[model samples]
Target chain A: MLDYKLLDALVAVIETGGFERAGSELGLSQSAVSQRIKLLEARLGQPVLVRSPVLQATPAGQRLLNHAQQVQLLERSLSRTIPALNADRTRLRIALNADSLATWWADAIGEFCREEGLLLDLVIEDQDIGLRRMRDGDVAACLCSSDTPVAGARCVRLGQMTYRALARPDYLRQHFPEGLTPAAFRDAPAIVFGPHDQLQHRFLAQQGYHGRFPFHLCPSSEGFVRLALAGMGYGMIPDHQSLGEVKAGRLADLAPGEGIAVDLYWHYWRHGGDFMERLTTTLTRKAQGCLTV
Target chain B: MLDYKLLDALVAVIETGGFERAGSELGLSQSAVSQRIKLLEARLGQPVLVRSPVLQATPAGQRLLNHAQQVQLLERSLSRTIPALNADRTRLRIALNADSLATWWADAIGEFCREEGLLLDLVIEDQDIGLRRMRDGDVAACLCSSDTPVAGARCVRLGQMTYRALARPDYLRQHFPEGLTPAAFRDAPAIVFGPHDQLQHRFLAQQGYHGRFPFHLCPSSEGFVRLALAGMGYGMIPDHQSLGEVKAGRLADLAPGEGIAVDLYWHYWRHGGDFMERLTTTLTRKAQGCLTV
Candidate 1:
């Protein structure tokens, strides 16, 4: 059996990004934390952490981290039933994409979080790649576009978010003086969320242009809309996020009838406890009202 | 003279994350890109990149990247004057915090970008640590709270942004039912932008509490406001962002009359040419109108 005391030290180091801060978080001395790590490595017969360039978990460390998180989840659920248990408000570390957070996520889960007295540690990632966070054992669960689940995880569809190619009217007048054309797309700058985001590429390809084009890379979802409204670039913005701006005439659809619907899924450990089960129920119920079929 | 061809290959590799993508961006074959990197490495007599785990430039590679970006800036300025030269619109890579980007940045610079036909590649970072992006040669310039300039960089004050600890009225009623006290603060859940963000810590310390407390780790500035509105936790939000909500009585200040003012400064290369110079002027002049001193 592995010792959780040592695992707690490892979790602290990763979360706080250093030994000193981890020591403070765990209420242990720096040297004591270091000793615990050493003990863990000796017990495992391999190094579990990579300390140079950046402090990150080795493959072995990641598996252990996932186990620790699962155990923590179970404990929290147990505490709810047994009042004598610690009952400290537990934080669930989860990975999610920004578009959802900016649009419907907080509204969907906020009430449940408040009632359950649960705190969240949210890691923002692109929807297509967010599953890697769960695969890497860095998060207990993740909301991503992928329907496939990791080995021990289960996934459920949570509806879809529809996106339209949007731009300012003046921007269209300036860049697409002729209307949406292959030539216009080749010349007009586009706003991409990030390097990992392929929505713009997919949208452009769908429009029959697959060549190098000028683009403005704006990572924040809110900033992405701002850039479009500012006439900086045309981009794919979610319907939920741009309804008001679109109605106000601050933004207009570049392709009126053309829209892309990205399917969203909730991926969690199959054995994740009553808390996870209830939270899943809450998210599904809320997402249905806000998201499209 | 150093071979710009080799340098371009290095820059493209870092920006695009691989040799194949670099080839596509630079209009060269994959092997051509690889050979250039090898030739550059041979000339430098050391590795310019760390390929394992993640693709990032080495320290020497970073210096070269900075040099290449500076050269690109100079070339773009020259091209603007001499239109026969390549007049392709240039994308300026800059680092800035999310709060500024969400609030004043887009509005302030949107017009300038549109007029100049410039595209932006923005990197979102915390204000306190944004300078490291410039130091590491990861960006052409950055907006940060520190007035100090990196070596070969010039900085200009762009006024200050004021933040207030804010929460929903009902959240305050539930968490601080007995008025704002040290005990109440110790128990109330707080929202922190990230681990690197010290705004909440500083605000709590100012209110005379220096102990570990529960906080929701939310990285998105927009989401942070949403969480506060959803009654998840109280957090320090910029006055510009929360003004409407606060005035509408959806959210209220936890500590009235107390505000933390973070000074904003524009840091850019000293010889960054006309583009950087004009950008600095525009930011300073516009910041005065929107940001509080």
Candidate 2:
């Protein structure tokens, strides 16, 4: 059996980003934490961490973290079933895309968390890349656009987020006076969410503009909307999020009839137990109400 | 002297994240891009990239990237001075925290960008850690909470963001009935922006509570506010961000008199030339109007 004490030391070190902080969090001396890591490496016959430049998990370390997270979830399931075993509330670490988190995620999970006495540790990532968190074993579950599940995990399709190329009326008037022609796209700037976000590029390509274009990259979902509202640039804004602005006539679709439907999926461990199952059910039902099916 | 062609290849590879994508962006074959990287590395007598799990720059590569970025900025300055030299617009990559971007940054920079015909490539990071992006040579500038500048960089104090522990009325009534006693805080869940966020920890410590308390880590600045407004948890929210919610009675301060003040700074390359200097002036002048000085 793997030594959980050693595994816990590894988890603490990775989570806190350093040995010193891990020691403080775990109530162990710095040297003691280092010794435990060494012992764990010796037992495994491989190095679990890379200590130079930055503390990161090696491939071996990631696998161990995945195992440790699964064990923690199972333990939490037991505690929940037998409330006398533990009085502390349960906390689940999840990797979620910023768009969902900004729009319907909180509402979807609020009542479930309150009723179950649960807390969340949410890691924000781009929907296109959130699954890497699942692969790296950093999060127990993730909400991403990828439908495929990682090894030892299961995925369920939740709903779809419909995104339209949207901008303020003035932005269209100033930049795309002739309306989204390839020639106009050459000079007009667009807004991209970030480096990993390809929505704008894809949207433009679909609109028959394949040339290089200038853009403003804004990472915050709310900030993305705000930038468009401020007449900075046209961008792909989800219908769920842009409803108020659209209704207020603050935003207009650059390409009125066209939109990209991104399907969202909930990826979690196959054996994540009763809590994960219940939470998934609640999320699916709530998300269905707000998102396009 | 380093060849500009080789340097461009290095920059494109790192910016696009792979030789394949870099090739597509630069209109070269993948092998041609690879040969350029090899030629660049041979000239430097070192490896430029680590190409295993992910394609990332080596320490030497980072230094080269910094040089390339400075050259690009200087070139842009020259182009601005002599419009006949280049008709292309200038783009500046910056790392900014979510709070500043959501609240005052866009408004602060919008007019300046439009007037200068510049585009922004924004990388969102925690204020406490944004300086690292400057060190890693990924951005031309950054807005962070750090007062100190990195090597070859200059920093200017912009202003301060004041944060208060705010929660919905029902949340306060249910969780902190006795009003912020250490015992009350032991179980009352708090919301933290992310792992790098220490405002909540500092606030709790200032109130004389040192025990491990439960917290929900919501990374999005707007999502953090939404979670708090949804009666999920109390979080330290900036006055700039929470003004509307407080005015609408959707949120209330847990401790009205006590709040944390985080100073914001603008860090840029010391020799980033005229564009950087003008942006620094505009940001400093506009931030003073909105932020506490």
Candidate 3:
């Protein structure tokens, strides 16, 4: 088994970007930190850090870093469960998309972390690709829209996040003065999440309008909504986001009852660590409460 | 020179995730798209797409995608500038952080995209590391804190984004009822952007307090501010985000005039694009107007 102290040093070095900053975090001298890493490399039979342009962990080092972080999370949960050993708030690193981070997941995560006395370390990326980070051990768990599980991980259905195809009343009036049609889709602009974000594209494909689509890409969950609100383009708006505007008729749901629902899944490491279950449970409970059943 | 049609087919295959989807985007049969990719690969003597559990571009493929996208962007700009040739709006992929997206950058980009009749495809990531995507040809340009230019990219100073360490009035009264101290930092929660995000830790280090610091991670720009407002933790709030709230004394700036100012830069490709200069100029002008120069 690899020495955890070595792994800790490796993680710190990669995270802080250098031995000096890592030394500061670990409360060790720069030479002391360097010695630990060297010792680690001696045992592992390979250099862990690449230090030319900038300091970063090698692929092997990243795996170790992710493992060490997982162990740290487990220890925190152990302390919480035992209620005897000195409780240490460990960092629980999780990956998620921008939309979920901005929506229901934020509060639910905060509440769980506070109660368990754990520190959260989130890795935000596109939902379709967020699982890739988890697979590479960049994060312990991930919240993704993909229902299909990767090998060595457990997937739990967190219910569907319904998205209504919405546009400002003025946008529909100006673009499709007659009504929505396949020809209108070619002319009118559409709001997309990002390049890799396939939600908007998939929605269009589901609508059976297969042609060259004009679209504007907006990054944030809120930013996309604002762009759609300004009548820049019609977009798939998450149903739970805003009730007031839709109810007030500020935005029109082009296809009522035809809301495209993306079923979300919480995928976590199947083995190792006690906190993953608790974290997963809390996220699922809170997510189900917020999402469409 | 590679056939633009084949390159377009390759790009569509990678971005849209599969041959069928790319076929739909390009208005061609799946076999036709596949044939184009095969022809391109035959000329290059390498496979571009990694067909497996997921569809993604090979390193060589990413380079070609970036080049083709750049060409498409330039052609669109040429059409706009010339006005005689019919212009087709193409996606202009750029990388930036979420904080900038939520703040003043969003509107500025929107205006520019509209004026140029171009589609915006933003690759959202942290400013410090977003430059990695630029180097990989994933984006035409990136808004980053790094002043050091990459080999082929030109960097322009966009001014400093000042961040005040702030919290809700009530959080201050409850946690550090006495005042700010080293002990208080150890106990009180602080909001962080993400795992790779070192802003909060760096702030604490600069404050001359180096110990095990407690922090809560919130990914989104607005989400973290909201959490800070909800008294979850004191965060480094970007100054331009809400001057009114700080002015009204709702969110207390824990350290006045001690705000951390991260200098921002616009780094882009030096050649093969006409609109990049315009985009960079508009961004720099708007950013300088809003940031602390």
Candidate 4:
């Protein structure tokens, strides 16, 4: 029931943003792009976008975009399966977060991509949002925070990604000489991944120090640890990157014997070839090996 | 009319994700958390959250969250205005992207933070989505893609980030010897930033090649160029990062004269003290100096 032209227009709007540029990208007039979007919205009986501040998909719009992307994937996979139909190579799009990329996902999956002759398009974003991308059919699969699967997708629990509250020994000595009290937290800056990363929040909350605390915003996961080690601030760093530093006396665990554990899940769509199934098996095993036992 | 207790519960839920966990975070029972959310929703007379596969803010929800965060920022700034209230160091949360942080924003803003006696928390996210955070009152300002300001924000055109179609000379010889034709595109793999980055999409559309092509998933901006140089795939590399390689003959620009230009913008809340104004002046001057004259 979805019109290809209309759907393409909608996608162009979301991708390029704004009607004028979407039209330019589609080689259509701005009015044509606007009219097509309106037609699609009318057909759907719901507004597809919220356009005042910036163009973004409404919930209904997101679902339709998902439908379009799923159709594209189906076509791409079909061409791969039936080489006579078309000769495009198979490229698997998987959504993941920064920590997984900086830690284990890429290395573990790199071999799989080579062996299966599969190209990969890693959609890196917030883990929770990454799974949403899978549900929206933006990516075929995602490694995300949720243990629960999206309606049609399958979910597998990968072991917990352990994050320990870490600080340079000198930072601990200077700021938390009397241990991590509310006053220490107020004085000492903590390095957070970004606005969305809750590792530091959970750590502080668990320690029962709530209120506005000083924090350094370092977006990179690896970079977060680097800053912490450089004595810029305390941070919750993944054990993969921090264990060695902690052992070498370069970094100290702020919360002794206490660590934040986020249980990761691998969620994938129901339909895929043997490659996907093998990937799931491979990914799960590799994660178990690298993550907390 | 909004209850602070209920809002706190909502913030906990948004931060920690699930109801049970959010309850745990707030030191309340799961039922208590659920009731608080339902009460808040009832009071608002509108559904705030789009609860399903992922926990995401609806437009209405985003507005409420923004209001809550704005109140927090107001309180914090009030302390700075009257040092007698609470002598905590003022932290300015600003949202930006990895490219800016990796390239020049950090160096440019470092002096401002030092001079203004401001502790900066940089929230690195997707530029458009980061502006969404600014709209939600999560950050004081953001560097984003929009020329139009969000509701009560101001927009400043920084400059354009130029991206050129780049690959190794060997890659160029193998894939695009006939220039960037449709056939060449189908055969050559491309390195893309992520699912949402449209730099390459704009380039390929300009070339009139609409087929699904093979692509390598490289998430890092600088890393995107590195991978392209490593012969993993051809990609649209940022002009700042690509120029050195192109000059040294280490990389070749496939499209010759053609390039993709994304005009960057700085958006901030309309109302601010001298610090924000000074930052705007400094940032604009610095960007003008480094970016294309």
Chain B alone, TM-score, model 1: 0.90
The candidate maximizing DockQ is 2
| Candidate closer to the true structure by TM-score (higher is better), 1 or 3 | 1
Q: What tens digits encode model 1's per-residue C-alpha lDDT throughout B1-293?
A: 99999998997887666788789879999999999999999999999988854577898997798788778788888988897898557668889989888778888888888888787879898654468778777678898888988998999888999999999999999899987787898788898887667788789879887656778888888889989988899999999899999999999998898989999989998788998899889988988888875
Q: Compared with the true structure, what per-residue lDDT tens digits does model 4 show for residues A185-212? A: 8777777776566778789889998655
DockQ score of each predicted structure, in the order shown:
0.47, 0.50, 0.43, 0.24
TM-score per model over all chains: 0.90, 0.90, 0.87, 0.67
Identify the leading candidate in terms of lDDT. 1
Q: Which stretches of candidate 3 lie over 4 Å from their true place?
A: A50-56, A77-84, A125-138, A147-155, A229-231, A244-252, A269-274, B80-84, B127-138, B147-160, B195-198, B217-219, B226-231, B242-251, B269-274, B284-293
Candidate 2 residue-wise lDDT at A9: 94
- Write one digit per residue (lDDT tens) for candidate 1, span A1-293: 77989999998887666788789778889999999999999999999889754577898997787788788789988997896997667678888989988788888889998888888989898654467767777788899898887888989999999999999999988899988787898788888887556678788778887566778878888888878887888999999989999999999998898899999999998788998999999999999887985
lDDT of 2 by residue, B1-293 (tens): 77989988987787666787788768999899999999999989999999754567887897787677678678778987897888446667788988988888877888788777787878787754567778877678999988877999999999999999999999999998888887889788888886556787789789987655667878888899889877899999999989889999999999988989999989998889987898899999988887999
**Better by DockQ, candidate 4 or 3:** 3
* Deviation (Å) of A101 in candidate 3: 0.8
Cα distance off (Å), candidate 4, residue B276: 2.4
How high is the TM-score of chain A in each model? 0.90, 0.85, 0.87, 0.73
| Candidate 3 residue pairs in backbone clash | none
